[model samples]
Target: MTTSQRWISTAINHALLLGAIELEQTDRGTRPHRLPAAARAQWPDPQLLMVEGQPSGMRLAFRTTATAIELETIPTKRIYVGMPPRPDGVYDLLIDGQLARQGSVSGGDSLTINMSTGSATHERGAPGVLSFEGLPAGDKTIEIWLPHDETTELVDLRTNAPVEPIGTNGAPVWLHHGSSISHGSNATHPTGTWPAVAATAAGVSLINLGFGGSAIVDPFVARTIRDARADLISIKLGINVVNTDAMRLRAFGPAVHGFLDTIREGHKTTPILLMSPIYCPIHEDTPGPTAPDFVDGKLSFKASGDPAEIAMGKLTLNVIRDTLSKIVTQRAATDSNIHYLDGRDLYGEVDSAALPLPDRLHPDGDTHRLMGERFAALAFAPGGALAH
Candidate 1:
């Protein structure tokens, strides 16, 4: 079919195409695939009968008893071939070194297990984790086409081993998006991102789409959130764009609106909240006229941002929040489920009283704990804004 025809066909049949994909290897030697950081933003964890490391990019071994499996996950979008202009996206799955499943994906997609019941379908939930179920109860090798751009790092694998099950209630689905801070910057483990902590507190499943150095408002992200399955959702916006000085004025406004518009497309009435950037003096009100300095020879940026920019009709935090508040407030008038929660409320002057983020930018693990607790109370608690 021609390109136009293919696009039309895909758009028409997209909804009908849904399910988890598999890439099994006949050879057991390559039991687990290593997915590295260099890879793009989304992908699956390597399947395995065993695992090692923090589980972020850990390795997994395949066991025999496993029959069929399904992987419901998010993709990193970056693929590599040991090269430069990094391959645009994810790698295809190969079974026993042969193409088994295509690696292509959309903004938000779900992978269902094709296997039958009694088998095990492991859910890594990692930006990329091999999803699986069903097995011969023996040893099997699952291979994932590593993105050429990323340095290989294997995450985790779920097995049919005799272990304690999580429970009957199943985990709550917590959808989260934020800057590198929420991406586990200085955190200890994948399960340690601040959002992860909050998920633990709420006893929910986590869908973490916190990209490092790329948290600017993107329509793709909002689209992802809209289609993503979640019992709750939170968006940590600002900060990254501010620090990188990504936007000046003209672009920021439409970006935010586009972001919101895209999200509302799929999740027409899902409970959504908008959060401003965390406290960072460097990007405060000062304008770009400010210069960079160094402490101990390390470069440090000054806010040098101008509140006047917003005053004079430029877009600033005061602008972003004001814009978001007005929009959400207005949206609330017609859309009761829509809401706005100030980032400051999460760690405003009062909450920051005893817990100051180490870098004055990102929250530390301990601070993450505090933030999660506070969020649980203010948003997730009974009668909380989110609950409502």
Candidate 2:
């Protein structure tokens, strides 16, 4: 313990890290990892590197008698050039099991990204502090959910009283992987993201592997899932593949099969749900290469690939849905635990018309709530696909 700073080691008692495979200690602080270091070494894409480094579902859970808590962190906030400044990533405080307060660091290093040019520029900033005070005078479980989209380095934790680490809370683990939509894009806060909402509704621990622009059925991702300890698993596939023009129908089927095969190797009977793309009108029948549309300075996506390519089995949302259904049916014949939930069932044409995706690719806050509520009822409710 450093008496001068009065900050205790997070590695000591009272800090329980969930949904992370490893923590890489750095000079500034510690960076959490969902994927193992070996897997990260295999895929060196700058985008993948950025996404994985952003701790989405990770949290600092502990049992403390302290009335006040403070944490110092260096967060890498993202900035999109020529767009409205994004809100700072939120740090939610859950006392006992309910939300007690929400806080955010005002100043942090910035990573300026130009989605149009696929370029990024980094700027250094000083670490900021988050404080929560005036707690009831008793032992309580405090969970600090990190920012979903920003890369954060946890530097120090200070409290008025000694704290102890929280053990497993006996919640079932839900390991989910998908695109930026699942990574909390456009979601108002970290806890408001669809997966976070669904995890809370269903009472499960979340291990979110949602990587923006990077959920393209990669084998390393499959292997990561294969090794994770999860009670339920889900993969929301297809959008990234289509948007990147990554694969056609032929490679798509094989890639999906291979990904599933790898996961099944470790979790032979664990309920695994495969979700197709939601109702994306621009990419419904047309192929992508989705291009960003800056409509009046706001970003939206439009399908840039030719609709005529469907004859050649180029991927589209509709076709991907059909393929996923067939794959689930065939797999379920041999493995009853395998299931399929059409992504449209979560967010469809009706929902789109009423609450269209502001970006034409990602759901807005309300839609995320709607999708989360619908998904929780559909997949985690009794007799639902993920019901354990």
Candidate 3:
């Protein structure tokens, strides 16, 4: 280490961490997890385990007078064996609450998955450093948003000047839960995610629980949200359930009710917005187990289940949306704090025409920004459901 540089222990610097529900000590450092250890212990699905550890909305917040800063981290990057390589997760640095610079680390570890075979292999590599220099003079609040799509283990924080925990800005905390789109699929960086964008615009603190492919209204997830310290809560449903064919119509309604019931037990009268899935042509009326389509070496998705199955209670995006709307409406009769939002309002047919989903599933970076802006306008506006 340089004589002028000092190392900050991430393990002991708990107050500097944000958006993570738990932090587990690792051999090299500490790994931030969106879900608490108790929830993780209940369900051991590999997909859920992986996505929950991705640290979608996690970041480090501190006040420092440093001109140069370096964060040492080991990130686990995921790759699909047959498909094109995914981009390295990007780290966003914010100075005084505005984006100042973006950076990324290379050569940490890789987890290659064979989607067709449902098997994955992990290879370890040395940690890399993300360095930022030439900050504006004087003390300033700094936020280093971690990669939204990668599992990063933070080793140490090095700076040329002293650093201290940043105090909260007195904004309401918005706890959001949803599928991969909300987890930042295809988004260029962590702050680009819709939840982050909306949170920033609405001036609310964000606690994102959007697990990729794992937002199936699990009881454990509901319990976690139930126990969280949130001033406002929003749960986006339907897409993952339809795409995974994880539930039939008969079970979907009760599962959602149960999920809300569990949360209400702890957060009585807390503003809760229940949202449907955004427009996705492939699953709007058709049922899924969506399967990957490799047409001309380009990745896309196709609904593998028969549309006729909907008559027999098979769940489709349309069905799930209708059910969710009805569920929220029913709950609102007694619980005035509960409300419903049609996801189509955020991203509908016009949006689909303008900026199509790049993979016939997830939206691209631009779309995420659009969605975030729309959400902020709708939810934070006067007389809006989430308006104080």
lDDT to native, each model:
0.49, 0.87, 0.90
lDDT of 1 by residue, 1-388 (tens): 1223211111101121111011223221112222122222342223111111112211121222334433323433222222233232343443332345544323321223322232333332333444433333444443333322222222223334421212213555666777766655555433345665565566555556566556677555566676666666778777766666667556776777778778777777777777776555545454443344545654344556566665555444555566667767776888777678777766776655577656555666677666667777777778765663
TM-score computed on alpha carbons, candidate 1: 0.58
The clash count for each model shown is 65, 2, 0
Q: Considering every candidate listed, which one attains the maximal TM-score?
A: 3
- Candidate 2 lDDT over 86-146, as tens digits, reads 8788988998879889999978789999977889999988999998877787988988888
Error of 3 at 18 (Å): 0.5
Error of 2 at 28 (Å): 1.5
Leading candidate by lDDT: 3
Output the worst ten-in-a-row residue range by lDDT, candidate 1.
6-15
Q: In model 1, where do residues sit more than 4 Å from their true spots?
A: 1-152, 155-169, 248-250, 287-293, 297-301, 306-308, 312-314, 351-353
lDDT of candidate 3 over 1-388, digit per residue (tens): 4566665544335588888888899888888988989989999888999999998988888888888889999999888886778888899999999999999999899999998889999998899999998888799999999999999999888877788886346778889999999999999999999999999999888899999999999999999999998999999998999878898999999999999999999999999999999999999989999998876789889989998999999998889888999998899899999999999988999999999998899999999999999999999788888986
Worst 10 residues of 3 by lDDT: 5-14
